[model samples]
Target chain A: MTAMSSAGHSRERHALLLMLSVLAVLAILHIQQGARPIPATVMLDAVLSPDRDAFDHFVILSLRLPRASACIVGGAAFGAAGFLLQVAMRNRLAEPHVLGLNAGASLAVVLVTTYQPVVLPDILMPFAASLGAAGLFGLVLALSALGSGRFDPVRMVFFGIALSALASALVSAILILNEDTLEQLRFWLVGDAAGGGAAAVWSILPAVALGLVAGCLLMPQLATFSLGESISVALGASVHRTRIAALVVTALLCGSAVSLVGPIGFVGLMAPALWPRLHQRPSLGAFLLVAGSGAAILLAADILALGLLAPTELPTGALTGLAGAPVFIWLVARRLT
Target chain B: MTSRSADPPTRSRLTAEALSVGHGGQAVVQDIELDIFEGCMTALLGPNGSGKSTLLAGFARLLPALGGSVRLDGSDLATFPTRHVARVLGLLPQQPPVPEGLSVFDLVARGRFPHQGFFSQWSRQDEAAVGEALALAALADLADRPVETLSGGQRQRAWIAMVLAQETPLLLLDEPTTFLDAAHQVAILDLLRDLVRRHRRTVVCVLHDLNMALQYADRLVFLKEGRIRHVLTHPSQCDGRIIEEVFEMPVVSLKHPQSGLPVFLPCASRQPEARP
Candidate 1:
């Protein structure tokens, strides 16, 4: 028994080391591989001791540094969020956006900024998104209770899909009615981290921190819940508590990214899919690995986005989608079969 | 929240008075009274859809009673907080889902959740409890094997091992030997009988085999059409007619040559001499 536990411990440690190294390399590459093509030595100088007058220093410090961190922070949170959502819902294919949280947040923001009288700053958008996600989640909860008082997995996912479709249609209608800010809205819709960079990353930091802390705390409980509701209840665990914790952590992670960059899709799905491949069994360590690899995946995607289309930077979401689509499709296929 | 600590525990050890159970606000069973004995094994037997599982669910407080209430040690079972009930009684479902890629030892260890806090470390006592449960279930050798890789009977025993690790005084099991072959069925029933005889733990299980229940359980409650038909205190006290009425199938009782326990056989006639 001691031998097996130690082996499991070593496996987790190996995953941790691997993900940290991968994140480090990708972060440096993310800063260096931009359109400006700063050399490795200059990138090191920009990171270590920035000379204020150097154009390279100004470019590295001002542009790529924040952009890289935002991707890492956002990706890590989403990775952890997706795994938690899957555990809560008891569905292997469940994703962070599977519950239509991003759709609710987007639609709420669009409606508030376009129709309402409140002139809010971009940073305050996450609060609106939080409200929207919470409201929609409540609606889902209430609707699921219509037939049975218990929360049914199929019913929850069904309502989420239907509501997401409805929200998307409403958003499209509002977008058509107000084409005046079409250019700005188009850029926001595609999801990029270039414009706000460092400021946006700092805003998202608390959400990421909240998600990481909460995810770590709630992870063990979530594993116990997969045994089914009766066993979980018999074990003295309140299934409702696990569900709420999952919702709160998911909301923090999803709201942080959607409000900042509109929505970065598929990092959550891919990170979880990739984590178990690195570790033999699912544990807290595997969860941490997923979060770390999520950051790595995003940073790598963002670097490609910046360098792929030279002067005109591509949207980070599009690049992740391009890489994530085949992988997501493959994962879904594996699960279905 | 837990009950007021000042109040003493209930008097009737796990009693249900005027119990009615329902799913989705629809009552399935109504007006049932039962007293579960401590330090004994009780078996619930009924035909398919006779509400055997439903009654167990009510006793476990998994379903709300349409009327009446369940009490443990004089305290209302529903009134006690979830963890408080769990500390005393543990229920193992018919086919509990084994987590993906988890080993038997780890799965059994998960049963110790009630005794643990979110911040509590895995203590030596927890280890001892898990080790003992695995040993009891005859699964100590397969402790390292992933649960999904185990055979149906072994997996069922593994689940029982997990519930044993919970270390609850009262255990309610829903069909512990459903899918096993006849040999394994006897093996599990023997194991459970050993539990009652040696450990003196209170066990309430829903079983399909009449002879098995007659041989193993100390008492049997027969239910038909969502109500208890009769309670048999001993195997010899059971009437063949009552079994026929509950199951809608004629049966005959035969004496086991060695143990002299009643063994039930399904046939057209209830006469003992209808053939072998």
Candidate 2:
């Protein structure tokens, strides 16, 4: 048994190493793409040493690096959030986008950005988004809990879809009316990484860190949740406390991701869903792998967004949604069959 | 009460005091007082809607008391930290949903949840406990196999091993032998009996089979209509009257030819409707 477990441990380490290496390569590729493509060596030099006079170095330092960082960080946040939500709800399709969290954040950002007369600081966007995500999630919980007095996964999923549609309609109505905000919010609405540059990344970083920390802390208890409610409780896990903590952590992550890059979809769904292929089941190490896989997928999407149309950048969100929809269908088909 | 003449002195590990348990404010088991003795397998026997499972759930702290308290070691069971209680009392509910692709060892190792911390790594002690539990449940050879692929008996044993891995002194099982073959039922019952006698674990389990309960249990608790009807310390003390009243069926009490254990055979009732 010990030998077998040690072998499994080594296999996990190898998988982790491969995942990190792929992510590193993706990050490099992400930073390398632009109108004027810079060589990898020049990018490396620009990062390691100070050469502020060079335009390429400045662009690498200012533009590409931060954009890549935002994509990675935001994607990771979404992945962790999705993993938590899926575990909590015991549904594979439970992600920020499906659960109305992203839409809620988008609505809040739009309301705060376009509706207000005063110019709000960029840092407040994540806070506004967090509030919206948490509020909408709470509403979803209450709505689902209405008939059953418990959070039924199916009911919660349906409620989330319905609420997300309503929230999306509200956002479209506000955007269509305010044409001035439309042009400014258009790229963000489609989940672009261009606006996130550095300041946006910095603003959401603390929240993401805090969320990841809380997720790590709650994972041991959360793992037992798969044993079903009764067994989890019998194992001495405080099911209620663990569940609430999972939700709060998810809100923090989804809110941060939404604020960083307008509500990107599918990373959360795909990352955790694809996790078992990398590892046999959910574990603490699998948590990090899920987060890393999320980062890699989003970064790859962003890279495709930058280079797909060659000077004409596409929306990262569109690409992710386009890629994610089929995967989502496959998941549903597999589950139903 | 009738066979107190040969009863051995025993300590009570769990004591329910005026305990009332309910669902959604409607009490199913009300104002119940019961004592679960240490190092004994006490089978809870009652008909459907008699709150047998509810009483078991209450003792496991899975349900909150409506009015009174359940005392564990002379302290209110509700007062102890849930994890603390878990380390002392393990429960195996009927139909524990096993996740797909979960190996038997992995499933059993999860029983160490209460003993683990956030940063404290899985230690040799945890591994040893899991191994001992697997060995005890006779699942060591199938440790690497997924629980879903196991036979009904092996799967049930895996679940039992998980609770055993908790190392709890008190175990509450709800119908551990349900849906198993006759041989498997006897195997599970014998295992529970051995757990009480050999390991000195206190057990309170709800059982549907009257003969099985009578054969294995050191004590029998009969509940009916949200109340405990009788507590029989010896199999000889279980008369047909209590069984008939609790189950609402006419039964004939007979002695087993080989073991001389009491057995109740239920009299047939109305037949099923004619099928097309």
Candidate 3:
């Protein structure tokens, strides 16, 4: 037992090291690959200690650093959010985008942007998104309880899908009627970190940090939850408490991510999918690895979005959707069937 | 049929008095009065829709009783916190869904949830309990195997091992032997019997196979139309008339060739005489 556990420990350690290395490489590439590329030496020097006068230092500090931070922060939040949602709902397909959380957040942002009597600053946007996500989640919860008093996993997912459709339609209608708002939101709506990069990161940090801490604290309880409700209840766990806590964490994390990056689709889905085996045997370390995977995938995708188009930046949301659609299909085919 | 006192001894570990449990708004099992004794394997036997599972659910506190009360050791079960109740009793629902890629050991380790707190997640006591449960379920060799990959009987045993790790003296199982072949059924039954005899655990299991229940169970509670029809201490006391009346089918009692215990066998319905 000692030998086997030690071996397992080392394997997890190695995997963590590899993931960190990948994230590091991606972060560096993210900082270097924008419009007018900075050389590697300049990038390193800028990161180590910026010279106030150097144009390269200014570009790295002002432009790329915040963009990169957005990707890592948003990705990690989505990853942890997705993992917690799946555990709470006990469904593999339970992710922010699929469960209407992203659309809900988007709808909130659109509503505030279009109809707020005064033009609020970009920093206050995530709060609206967080409120929307939580509100929609309550609706989903109430609808899931329509038939059985118990929260059925499949029923909740179906309701989320329905709510997602409704929210999307409303958003499209609002955008079409208001063309001025449409042009203003044209780029931001598709999930780009270029415009309010630094401000977005700072705005969403506290909520995301709170959500992640809550997720970590609820890890042991969530592990029991994966065993299904009856068994979880039988084992003396208050399933209701765990479920509510998990959903709240998911809402905070996902709402903050959506507000930051304009609902970058599929990071949540891909995060859990990346650590399929780890989810089966949930541990705090495994959960962190999943969150890390989400961070890495998003950072890499954002870099690809920037690098692939050079001066013409593709929306990170579009790139993630392109990558994540197939995974969503695969999970449905494999898990649902 | 032999008639006796409806109220058993006061020392019963788990008891249900006037318990009416159901789904939605309607009661499926109504006015159930039964006592689960200590250190005895009690099998609930009945036909389909006889409320066997419902009664078990009531006892396990998985479903709320519509009218009456379920008691654990003389106290109303609803008064105690769920976690405290869990430490005293363990329940295995019928075919609980197994998480993908869950190992037998991890599955058993979950049974230790009631014992551990937030900071004291995985202790030496937890490990020892899991190891002991794996051994007790005869699943030590297959501990590392994912439950999805195990054979039906082995998977069932692994689930049992999970409940065993709870270290509860009373166990409530809803159809533990379902989906198993005859040999595996006997093996599972023997395991339950050993639990009662060797570990002194009180077990209440819902069984469909009358012969198997007759062969293994120390006590049998027969149900019909949401009511306890009869309760017998020994298979020798059970007769075909009660089975025929409750199930509404003809049956014959045959003595086993080796053990000479009476086994109830369903017989063909008697045909009506010709009009002539």
Predicted candidate 2 versus true structure: per-residue lDDT over A249-275, tens digit per residue: 898899989988889998989997765
lDDT of 3 by residue, B1-276 (tens): 122123343359898999999988699998888889888778999989999998998888889889889999999999999999999999999988866777787788889999998789778898888888888889998877878999999999999999999999999999999999988888888788888777879899999888888878778999998888999977678888988878888888899886667887777557756766
Supply the TM-score for candidate 2: 0.95
DockQ of 3: 0.55
Q: Judged by DockQ cut-offs, is candidate 2 incorrect, acceptable, medium or high?
A: medium
**Model 1: clashing residue pairs?**
B10-B73, B10-B74, B11-B73, B11-B74
Give fnat (model 2): 0.73
Q: Which ten residues in a row have the lowest lDDT in candidate 1 chain A?
A: A275-284
Q: Which stretches of candidate 1 lie over 4 Å from their true place?
A: A119-123, A136-162, A172-181, A277-283, B1-12, B268-276
What is the fnat value (0 to 1) for candidate 3? Answer: 0.75
After superposition, candidate 2 runs with Cα above 4 Å error: A115-121, A277-281, B1-7, B268-276
DockQ score of each predicted structure, in the order shown? 0.48, 0.63, 0.55
- CAPRI docking class of candidate 3: medium
Provide TM-scores for the models.
Answer: 0.91, 0.95, 0.91
Minimal lDDT window, size 10, model 3 chain A: A1-10
lDDT per residue for candidate 1 within A27-132, as digits (tens), equals 9888887557788999888889989999999999888788888888878877787777777777665665656776777778678867765887656667777667
Q: Which candidate has the highest DockQ of all?
A: 2
CA deviation > 4 Å runs, candidate 3: A2-11, A114-125, A140-162, A172-184, A335-337, B1-10, B257-260, B268-276
Clashing pairs in 3: none
